[model samples]
Target: MPSDVSRSSARPGGSATDLAAVWAVFTDMYEAYLAGDRARIDAHLDPEATVWDSATPQLLLGKPALDQVRAQRPAAERAGGGPVEAGLTAYDQVIDVFGELAVCRHWLRIDYRDRPSGLLRNTAVLRRAHGGWLITHLHEDGQAAD
Candidate 1:
């Protein structure tokens, strides 16, 4: 909800705990995207962040690139409508935290427009910055749904 991520006691210690913490941040970022809250999304991303998605061949690097992509999208898609629904069901999630850096790998099921559009294999790299974890790099490959 807020730009800042909240930590819970339920998330305990060790890799699992760390993973949960990072996952919370990730979900928050995703929610911001869905809500079209550019400020909130910016808060969760590093200035040098890069992302690759199935729809694009060019790597999206930096906030300007992200903005351009968003501007190119249809207003309805950006604003959200038409029975649109998306979910990220992550499996085989692995998070490795080293000092201030963390890498997460997971298989994700992405449902779009109320249908199972695709399965995505994702790897995200985060860095502890600006008082919280911010996504620095994200790579995704979309595959045919089962």
Candidate 2:
């Protein structure tokens, strides 16, 4: 978990731990994103998953497409010379589990080091595999900050 991010109470399957586990997958991904660690992010993604990223112009069909975007990051960002991400906050989190599948929805606010903060509404679908969770689908849309 990122020490800069605060975790909110989870709502899922009547088990806080289940939500905790699911939350970990995302927190881990967020940490990887901040570090520009593509491999770590890939580990949590399902091979056939889809992503509708907040800044992308079109839907990203799978891990390959996601990787392509990661590869296009600015050298300044990859080298840690850009504005830092002060922290991330999630609000109105909701998670529901059905058998081995789970769905999560939350609104995220990212506080940047020297830029205007950004907000995104996100949703994710996850499946249980190898005793862990993998994201099968993710959608993020930029939102106006309040």
Candidate 3:
């Protein structure tokens, strides 16, 4: 069984709608994070996905890494907390709608803890496989203030 119930496959379809569905998954992940819903965030992301940041000194790989991060949250604040709030400054996204191969570039400004208070740009590539869209790779590099 998957570590969390939310991580289980929620949808099963391979069509044009998958594009929007997959994108919704990404968006939901962000929203869930801001809401301090760690299970929801993990559910939306692939188990093999990697998280990285240009400013951070390490790369977080797979659900285990993400789970570890979530585990650090205090029990009282794990579900919903003021610190979970983040302002999304910008979202410049580009999506290539190929039948099987797609790439999405999301430029964002996040206010997570222990991070600078500026924009942090990121890119993600997704592939349609096994009747679903899976995030194959992602890279995020921070930009210092001018």
Best by lDDT: 2
Per-residue lDDT for 1-146 in model 2, tens only?
33221344444453666677777788778878767687898899999899998868878999889878866878787678777898877666677877688888878889998999989999999999999889999999898887
lDDT of each: 0.71, 0.80, 0.60
lDDT by residue for model 3 over 49-89, one digit each (tens)?
Answer: 88774534577788787567657757766655535435554
lDDT of 3 at 82: 30
User: Candidate 3, which segments miss by more than 4 Å at Cα?
Assistant: 1-19, 69-86, 111-116, 129-132
Select the stronger candidate by TM-score from 1 and 3.
1
Superposition-based RMSD of candidate 2 using all C-alpha atoms, in angstroms: 3.1
Candidate 1 lDDT for residue 2:
24
Q: For this target, which candidate reaches the highest TM-score against the unseen true structure?
A: 2
Error of 1 at 94 (Å): 0.8
Would you list the clashing residue pairs of candidate 2? none
Candidate 2, which segments miss by more than 4 Å at Cα? 1-14
